[model samples]
Target: MKKKLLTVAIGSAVALTIAGCNSSSNSTDTDTNKLLPKDATIAFAGVKAPVTDAEKRAILASDATITTGSDSMPLDLEYNVFARSGDTFDHAVFGQLVDKQGNPLSKEDGSPSIANSNEFTSLLPRGERLFSVSQFESRPGAMFLMELNQNTENGELSVKDAWQIDQSGVNGGWVHCAGSVTPWSTHLASEEYEPNARSLVTGADAAADRYAAGFLDYFNGDESQWNPYQVGWNIEVDVQADSGAAPTATSKKHYAMGRLAFELSYVMPDEKTVYMTDDGTNVGLYMFVADKAGDLSAGTLYAMKWNQTASTGVGAADLDWIDLGHATSAELSDYIEGANQLAFTDIFATADANEDNSCPDGFTSINAGGNGQECLQVKPGMEKAASRMETRRYAAMMGATTELRKEEGITFDPTRSKLYLAMSEVARGFESFKKNGADSSSYDLGGPNHIQLEGFNRCGAVYQLDVASDATIGSSYVAKNMSALVAGVPATDSYGDGVQNPIVANSADYADNNKCHIDGISNPDNVTYMSGWDILIIGEDTGSGHQNDVIWAYDFGTQALTRIQTTPYGSETTSPYWYPNINGWGYLTSVVQHPYGESDSDKDTGNGENRAYTGYVGPFPAKAE
Candidate 1:
């Protein structure tokens, strides 16, 4: 396949002619016909530095020249803000909380309660029509469906109808963070930062208390029916849309995947293997291999063990897996609905450790899921239930590494048989493991210290994992090796003296705004890999690493990082996904979430409107063979 350059101008509304681009070297002719050429490069020009204008810094803005290659083709890369937090479409208000019958819930002021933190979105095409499912990242989370109308001739998209998906059937979602579309065309969403069951039950956690308040509000103040086990599993939603009627969505929680604070779940090409990332401190990386292809109802769960080879530059490791047992979703669901309800005490017994951090004779001391060191003993005859329901604790009990910090988004590169995972920050247990080593009692308590690093990098890093066949797991896409593909560069002061920030006050200089190198990524949260193009799109969710979160495009061929977009101050760049071809039109979806909600909470404009945005970067022409 031959390649051509495509130039896109912002705010111009110009259109470009379709041209043949490079095809993937390993891709088949049929696959090549469906995607862009492998040699074709998507590059961004201009903007050598971060945004400095105060007005521009307060809004979502982009000033980059998007081009394909050397040849010139006129295309307009437009920014579309189609949906906001409180906007209404098709008689349904976005981000609005709803009841069991799908009616909108009201706030104390009698206004419709809305979710401000919107995260992942999946665009699914059905015949000539398109539908999108978006998740809200809040306590007692929510999800909605939108019918998108695309002008095939002009490559423009618009939402025609929208409504909230009913979640009462599987209990309400909690902190739906990020998601992906399955090969079978279902939306796979996540429930992040699962409330600590023991803490919630004992009223010992203030944060859990706050979460329970919001969750109780969702149930119309029904405190007796609250259940913490119902919200942490991966949820799969199947949408069926016909020609003229509203789409119907059916959802199920896959309890077989084990309970964790899931950031997202990425399924491998084989369909039986899945990689799931846990999102907080002292978290563990997990994998689930389904008993049958294309089904997640029953699977074997495994935790990662990082055997370190080098302790420099984000480190390197040979990966091993620890089988954590398995069960069907039905079995776990039965436990949730049964008379016992599987409370924290039913599966394990806990006790306070001595001042020296030593556990009793029968209890094991372990740290997992940012809960700090805990002394616990698994009850007899409840190991299977504990493995699936109290996953992090059980994994730690089985001697798996649980020192990962802020593990975020995941994407696969089938051509290279590789997987990319984002670690939002390289601190907390990650730094402690390096300083204390595996033998130290201060870190990794009861688990092994598989990862060791040289220094702390609060700016974070992106890791690449090699996938291969594992006979024991009976999957062809098991992750075998892990290493850092790219890491953020921590910045020093103007005098090159202090590693930490020297400028504490707000300054007019642009260089003082960020603690990490402005040219590299910081606190990368969501990542998407464009297969044929060899481009990785990285988004940031940072409060102090960078002043304004950015969306970056990294080209593997040239190893160049380009700043494609920047969100408002205190906002996050989320859901950077690429849909290669959707009815002869392509899109790169991007969402700017919670403007001025993070770092600049007190610096509101006072216009009475602060809503999150959901939109995309382009409608690139989809070429056929």
Candidate 2:
């Protein structure tokens, strides 16, 4: 194959240049006769090695190398920090809580409270200036906007102003997680782990009570107006930033998309079709086709039905979408406003299973959202309300598969007509057709036995879905089939035995303390696809699956997985996004969230205060066409 030469500059003041090459052995290589677009490619010398140093592993570390594609003059990875958790700008702290009037919030002791779990950071370029929105993942979630100034000469970004976006309009955001940038140049954020209104009002869940208490603070201790149904939807933020005046943000919640634990919603090239991944055990995959292009106000919701094709590895399936009906965001908002006082029993009729775990003939037996088997029948005249408000349960009632475990992120590959989804783990409902192999119809009953993998891999896998036009859906970007693209290899096959052993540190048989293969991905969370380069950037959110979470660069043409960045011991690798070109520069945005917050919490000591980091990988040169 012929190689294309490009120039890459390194260092601050002194520009050291070298030749970068784009060499591909696959059939998908760029045509030599055709001119490469400005966003087509970037040249890198080599991948970084895995971080294993005890001290370095306890903090963010990057050794990735880039080059002018020359063998010599290789450049080390350069991470540009935009801001940290508590960094102050525009008279407001980055992760600090603020009220509707932009006043800092305080805890019960009258002490300033701050959030450290920054999950998604999106940089939206408007005209000559740049804008960014970062969401804090907490009980009463918060989102902040920052105005950034780019030094055109060197591609360095500096935060000029920052302030929290008010969420009072949507009953306050909850558990904001992974997000994406829409085709219409807006920020699409997600509210994960939607509070189960059923359990919150029907039963006594201490965890739910605690969450309600914390969330009530967002309303100034107003419990009478607490509505769980108002949250758990996709939020779109339209940032209006002009040359002279400060930037203003307007947010709207898209209830047209069914309520579930959304990891992220990825809009296809068509702009009208969207794929939403639900995170958590016994969750379901969903897609929404909007009535109008670039508008999410009204849509038809559909859930995926997985038809198992293979039982080996992470399993393969032919996908069929189950239509869960449609509604407008305004209509769904009306339902929540009117039914705020209603309990789970008011919307659905339920019956307890017999001692032998068999439900009565009338009610449907299904398990969803990790909720145990329940016999439920949607009440009359509540089908539309049930479908939008209780999406997972309604999907199960419609015979859609709800067996996905920790389904995390979704990114589209327009060139290949493919969509990649991250399943943080391949365990629980994914490992068996029948829960616990029970013969009784009511025992651990779910929507359908669609996925049945041979072994349990807690290390997780990334699945690829083939997309094509469907006349029935009236959209050209519907997913038709799915299979594992890249999967992590667990240290042991815990299938059937039901014994999950911890990672054996310093084991001579395995490499170091890693429970999964050192080279493969572990707990893949948020993924982004670089368009012209055909590279999928995957980030990890793992605990025992791997000692340290790392970011990977998977080249589709070469089928090579390269470790590009590694985070601290307990931090999660998040918000890996590709901005092909912003002004004259290209960037790969990355966010390291909650350092030492997971398994390594006890290891957090000294000045390493476990703050989250929002930054980008590089300021690569913009390729020319």
Candidate 3:
């Protein structure tokens, strides 16, 4: 049997040279003036590591203070609420429903036309709508168009009413996760929790299929066409218009981006290239290059294949790209119409056939009855359905690395030219390097062709991948150097139930069993980079032993992390978004989901008390130069 490659958590810092920033004197600092907040009172360059839990407790106990011009405790951006729980958020965006002339539809009152729109209103409070056990239903997730009104007298800025764009999921908006603003000024809303149909249904026998059959219920309405393949594509919303008009937003699912539990998509400066992160177990990192710049409808997809020099999940390694090919939804529909389960199976069997018509080495075969078998290798004829629908399985067939566990948010930092990927937990057979105060070497070579790194721990991590400088469209690329920006200490005990019970340090004075010590950034989830300020906003979604999830700001320059805000107990801080110059002041949007937690009953049926909040933080005035 081939070894399953272990997911490594290696982090090593490199000297960074600021990119695109000009070096000029105070009088001639035009570029500097443009990048810096015009009324910047404090310099927001570096960050400080997280404070102790006791310190955090005291800090939370008191009102957050912002001392202007204070370098030690720099509070550059003042945080404020945009929308709270039960407001217009908590719903999903279907797409930017546009007419023939490409204008957004609206009613006489200027409210978006929800009727003609394709947003599925039924899938809200996702668990209730899909599980079939609950009569109560919740709303889908939504995107807000916030208006920042500048105060004429004090030069302060505040957010006006954030108008609702559109809310429906008819075109596929299930569990809207992390998002990104495209170079063309559009919002890319991603879908999470979409199951893989090929591996879950067709690949298994009736007995095995019965266990996985429930996943087909993820898509409602048309059960005939509704398979695990439909919901997980990157859903784009056109909310990037100017703030003057009641900013109308629309949505569209990019079928070419591959259907998976997407965390987010980051488009490169080149406009045509995009990096999409899959937020699930045993997933792959993908890159999509559009046929035309700024047009995402058609594109080619590729997955990453790692070449490791060491076994530790940490450190530098080379990355090879596997082209999975591409096809549109129309083409896919046609292919599926002509191909049945037996046809799809034959496609794989034909590709799996060697000269002797036997499965290849390292490939496993499972009986599908009546002498039909399925092989775990790339079948040349299976690219179409596999690429866009059964993405993870397709990548595996193409020899791409598939050991990543919960590969969450991916944000590009233009200044450092580095892309940061948050792996919620480092433990999936990866052991810690410093176990019991000594070097414990347990790095193993696992996965196909020894293409995966091995390590330990259930603590989380953020990987800094430095891709090539001149990467072009459709070109295979490698991580020039890959390092862990920050890695949480491995969990001490998980209580034998298999889930990690991270032992966090209570005080900065203490060190042992401090798995959650690095200033409480364990289980890092949604992340985004404020390029102008060089701040990486990281949010958390951790399990027990960790109280409320907090959002942190990590300064790449100082290598320090500071906890910015704490969510309600048992809530996950989500989607830390930054939009510069919203009414001349920078603005951020984040959410706290399922505040105060939820019960099994609450999840099954909608509980009015259990709600998610969409917060708007920022509008900090520019300080004197």
Best candidate per TM-score, number?
1
Off by over 4 Å in 2: 1-76, 99-102, 108-110, 202-208, 338-342, 433-446, 492-512
Question: Distance from true position, residue 111, model 1, in Å?
Answer: 2.8
**Count: clashes, candidate 1:** 4
What C-alpha lDDT do the candidate models reach, one value each? 0.76, 0.75, 0.50
Over all chains combined, what TM-score does candidate 3 have? Answer: 0.67
Q: How do all the candidates rank in terms of lDDT, highest first? A: 1, 2, 3
Could you estimate the TM-score for every candidate?
0.89, 0.88, 0.67
Question: All predictions: root-mean-square deviation over Cα?
Answer: 5.2, 6.2, 12.2
Model 1 lDDT tens row, 1-625: 1111111112122233333432222111234354544444455552334454453343332333224456544344545655878888875798998765666788899987898798998888765567889999976789988888676445566778788888888888788999998888889999999878877863234234866567666676666657788878899998997867668889999999999999999888888899999998899899999998899999999998878887776777888899999789888887876665788999999999987778888998888886778899999989889999999989988888898889999999876888989999876577544432223444555555566676657788999999988898899999898888888776654412235554333444545677777778888998998755668888899877788788888878787888777776678988788887665566788887887788877656755335787777767655442
- Checking candidate 1 for backbone clashes, the offending pairs are 22-37, 22-38, 23-37, 23-38
Q: Name the top lDDT candidate.
A: 1
Better of 1 and 3 by TM-score: 1
Residue 474 Cα positional deviation in candidate 3, in Å, after optimal superposition = 5.4
Q: Rank the candidates by TM-score, best first.
A: 1, 2, 3
**Better candidate number, 1 or 3, judged by lDDT:** 1
